[model samples]
Target: MVEVAWPVIHATQVEQVIAVFLSREHPHALRITPSQGDKGLDVIVEQADSTYHNFQVKYFATNLNSSQKRQIKKSLASAISLHNDKDSDFDLSLWILTMPWNPTTQQLGWFRQIQTDLACPFSCEWRGLDYVNGLASKYPQVVDYHLGNDKSRLEQRIKDLENFQRLRALAGMPSADSTLVPQDLLTPLAEVVQAINRDDPHYQFSVEAGPYAPPAVSRPGLIASTTIGETQVGPFVTFHVYARYRHATDDRPLPLTIHLNEAALTEMDRAAWQDAIRFGSPVTLAPGSFTLDIDLPGGLGVTNGEGTLRLFASDLQAPQPGPVRWVIVGPASWSVIAEIEVQNGPATRGVAGGIEFEGIDSTGIMTTRTRATPNPNGTFNLNVTISLAPEQELIGLPVAQALQILRFIDAYKPGNRLAFGPRWEPIVRDSAQLIQIDAGSATALISFLTDLNLVSNECGAPASVPNWRELTRQEFLGVRNAARVLAGSTARLEVHESYIAELAKSDIEMLPKGEPVAVTMPTQFELKVAEQKFVLPFTEISFSRITIESSDQTSPDPDRGFIVFRPMEGCEITQSMPYGAEGDDSLE
Candidate 1:
């Protein structure tokens, strides 16, 4: 009951249908005309001697309407002219083959009268959809060739087959040697069997009342029997036939009830399932290390420089299936680096110094820069600038953690170095020392020193250390020497090069600004100098002869400041003199 769009049917399919119909209806019919150059004739049949029959296959979306009839008449006229010009001696019969539609008696009579009035040695006939449908019914291949089966039904059948194959393979069963029947074809066979096996009274009573009826109920004889085998693989039982059937009839319904143990099926091949479920590629990275490279930034010789390099897997928790290798080669590079700790928002700010370094920021762009101070003995000082905004601190606590990792490279090390040919190469080491070099403000310098544990209070708590103003010049010198030693040992330095650079870079904007007002922390005042070298502990050091500088670039009132020093029990101040004053000075 499906209505087909006849207009969408290709002309080639119409020709094929006609050819197939003719081959079956008239086995000896010879097709003399080719499809392309046949004028109005699609196919030609040679009858007795000189008699010929030609068909013009016409498929229409609807019945032969007025417009369609006119088209057909024009084609007929063209055919008549071609026949007269080329084959005048032959007797020709023209036929218009179309889809199913019945014409009125008047229309048929009119067509016949027109054919008679043509005044040519030919006959005309109209074959519509009814005739085509009859041909299609007899030869169902015609319908299948034109209109395919339902796509959803085909897909379901494919899925069923795939499932069956997969399950059979999993169960380790031998595949069937014969081809499987398509679902579309098997459906009709199943319906026919169901119809014949119906429990209707007409069929049952007639068969049972016959002379060959039952005869003691036939003892329930076994018409056919086959063994159903089951093999247990793990918790699931795999059922399959082991041997071929000698003479089994499949017309009867199979007495099969398939019960799949879902849990057992899911548990099969646990390792493989887990492996398949994993995501992403696995990578192994070596721990971070330091590197010293010598470069000629200003056409100089190899200079000593130190930086740290860290390697980490882009994704660590997955397994990858390929070889892993690291390649390193480059000049120098720089990038803005910020380290943030969970407790403290932003922990550190610095720049990573390296060669050919690449890192993505929040904006998803790679940032890079390169600059180094060349020193003697192939040792160059790596100058990295770090910026800390005033607003980054919360309640006197640093926001960002201090920058720890400074530089990195992508190369693998062989022995003690990564050799990139003879011309360029950098020496790689496992560890290096980091130091604090300079600071912009006294608070910054004292904070950095306290952080390094170089400055501490009487209780030896670095956190209890007072502000910079409370510390004497001697105590400051002692703290600075301690910081220098720590820096040399660690090779790390806290510097404010970024602030200087920013000021220099924006000199035009700051030229008209006035001198900034002085700011001080009032609650913090005392700084006790801890033991330096062999000195006793808890010795409070205070600055004397304090001088205040004013914004006018001149010394302020000297009487405004006072000096006080808290000495230890054994210590005595024998003579006190201001630094750089020519006088007898001794500490006893």
Candidate 2:
């Protein structure tokens, strides 16, 4: 029996386990991820008939309760809304509420009541701990990777490692592993042991199962899969096998036998394994579920970035649901350090790394976090969060920026502020609010809404605000420009200090003087504004050449002077709004 605590498992792990199960059972039908902001639908299994079986997985450590019931309802409502949308991708036929733990008898009643109260247009079902355990009995690899215990395959691997360590310590081998050797076993016994370890190939590895398609989820009918396992093979996994043979040892390292429970090994994989016997680039001989790509820093063997093995379990979409079974059989020389598993699919918001830009304005906080993950396919997954503090951005958000924020305002929620670093680790924390709305917060929104020319400034009866779709193209253009400004992080000198008032009509602009020595004093300069041109008198003028670049600043007292000139306002630069047939699709 798999004696593992169900509730303690992370919600993400629970989701992956179910996904793996569905991927096996429904292989072709298991859609990767259904929705963008995934509110209702978590796992979508699209059958050949074009009908969808949607599962909303929840990691409720405890029995079903009122709060969970409410959550379930909300999720159902959201999923229904998606289905109602004409543009939606799938035809919803069944709704599944799945969790890691079994519910109590009373909890089951609550679940049934929820299903009945919703009066769902589609069939509804529940899957709990028993469902997962049933799958685990057959797919033990899943448990060995995620919910492992003392009696697990993972445990046996650990025991093997401990035994190896005991023997190594008994032999009193050096803490470091080495490969350089010219003599045979005639060297010291300890030296012989070290030499054997170098050639004997002590290595570990890992495997990650993903879709052959770039994103590995969402789209249906792609019908291909890939299994990537990495470990050292040539040196341990490279071409330096000659070094291993240098010291007297067994004939050669035994070739590893990789197994995929479902798909047959592709001819490419077979050829790759054949090449492995010759000790060519072993990177193609991916076999195990979890194989270390390289030795630890300063550990031993041909340790570098180039050492990695990749294998494939490619298969077309099968007609019916089945489990994904991947296995590895290696020689005694190559030990199973661990058969690790569990990972967030492409849709997971939690990222391996991310970037952030934040600033404080009027006691209100604003943050923009962005993460882009490139997929094997040309397309990529981009996650961006533009959050505002005091959430409603009351006092003043740039009018243009507020318009953009208002577009996706529904995604915002009220919460304390927190920041994450590149490693996706928390770097800052504060009572700073994520968002909220009230007279205080809405004050700015209200004033800005008035700018829309929707309501009258004259205080009177309350009226309905204009819809967001009602916004003009120019308004959207402003938002687009603002987004570019934030994303580009570019700056230019657009303004200058003031001078005389009599020159108010003068068209003034500054330009860098390329070569000072090329010209002397009394040089005339022409300035143009729009179609009109203006010339300023060179009275009391001085030139500063070094001001243009650092290399010119040869002296401590670099040239410091100004050539003052009057400037006139320029004509507005305008482009037609992208709203009609002639609209630009570049931004899209």
Candidate 3:
């Protein structure tokens, strides 16, 4: 058996081996050397579609340290910069190749974070020892050429494992004992769990909702109040820190330090405070004892309030003694008020505005309105109001439920066009029209064209008259043109600003209008040529009586203007007219 250390392999040799393997795997791919200052890309494979797959080879004996990791990050950043500068027309996939060892879990997490921060257009992958081993297993010749030996030992090791498994089965014994379990598999799981549960700072601290004052009714004084409390696990020194609160609508920070007092730190062990400064690292104290709470006088505004508290702790003692713990507290709250209103309703006895629909049991409805009002706008207005409870005032509205409600409301919007098929229906032309749209928290009021003295079969009116009476022929023609234009068009509807002001739930005060409502009425004339039947697009279609006689006979007088059909290009007029008349004038 021959042994070859992976760390001894040169970077250039690794690149060549990878190139060979890639070429074998993808016969159509073309390999090319990158030019000088080619970012982090050492070897590039170009495809027929102009897509580029880049590879960077690094051979190392041991795991990367913090500095080495930073170096790799910097190199990747430079490569990203170069890629952006070139603005290449093709998509790119970058592969970072390292041999002998894979990156640690922490290093992989860091790499993922960096990838997200950069937001590069290209895809990235980390090809470590496992990837190299995979390639070697597939192409033994390539591995032997580079490493001076085949994968005989690796093959033997696999056989040994197979033999061990068979022996264990024959003996009727368990396949794995504690001693047989590889340290690599167990160590990662143990370390990750410990790191998440203990070392992670987020798990060490927590913030909770506290006491609050009721919201005022006045416009300027309508301040929702709340308290913010933080709890830290284990014993640590406490310090009074400056606090600030930001309003949802404004960027200016409001001073919350006035509310901070010693009483807020009552949860912290008074006994621990005496020895906290004297104690060194790993000092033990009673669990669930360290806490700090502060009351917010003004609470969050009618919208939202985000508060941040900063503090410092001195724990380093022996070699370098200074403040070692730096804590930043960000506690947020919102004063959310959700209201929904409907415009008009039928009058009923004992109902103030309209009627109230309440849930029957104690487990009442979480959403939906119980009260409805009849507005003067000839519509029913249903109102549902929601305010943040004292406990939830600090956190504002629950994110999960709020998203669900918003999604439901979004799904309730009107679709584009209402189809009435080919049949014409009677539309109330002179009545007061009410357009009610459910737009989440906002009320939409839409105005449409009305009172047009258009031609209609609903009112028992003739299709066409000898003399235009109440409605002129010109007016009828104009209405037809307007209807055609309005068929597929869209219109915007206005939302009442007062509804938004009252709710304070959303900043959007308008529901954007949807596609125009089209009304199609039947025309007077229908034409049939051969097998195809055509409905005239125009509504003002009319027909008149006409007389046609032979050349030897005298023709009778024409009664009225005759309607003619003109065939445009691409239209096939298969049948000939009775008199052999052609071009421009075809009677239907």
**Cα lDDT, all candidates:** 0.35, 0.40, 0.36
lDDT of candidate 1 over 1-588, digit per residue (tens): 333345567766665555555544554444434545555565566676756677666665454577877766666665677677764543566555444455667768866765566654566777766676676656443355445523244664565556555544444533475444344334544443343323211111011112221212111212211111222222221111110111111111223222222344334333322222221111111112222233211121122322221211112111112211111322232111212111101111121211111122221111221123334575644432233333222222321112111111112111212111111222232211132222133345534445335433322443322344556766665455444433332112122111111112122232323332221111111333533222212121122222222222222443232222222333322211123333211221
Error of 1 at 365 (Å): 93
Q: Arrange candidates by TM-score, highest first: which order?
A: 2, 3, 1
Misplaced by over 4 Å in model 2 are 24-35, 103-109, 152-588
RMSD of each: 34.3, 26.0, 32.0
In terms of lDDT, model 3 sits at 0.36
TM-score of each: 0.24, 0.30, 0.25
- How far residue 413's Cα lies from its native spot in candidate 1, in Å, is 91
Instruction: For candidate 3, write residues 453-482 as lDDT tens digits.
Output: 122222222222111233444443443443
Question: To one decimal, what is the Cα RMSD in angstroms of model 3 from the true structure?
Answer: 32.0
lDDT of 2 by residue, 48-129 (tens): 7988888787777576677777887898888777777788876789888877677778876876776677666688787877
Lowest summed lDDT over 10 consecutive residues: which window, candidate 3?
Answer: 442-451
Best by lDDT: 2
Candidates, ranked, lDDT: 2, 3, 1
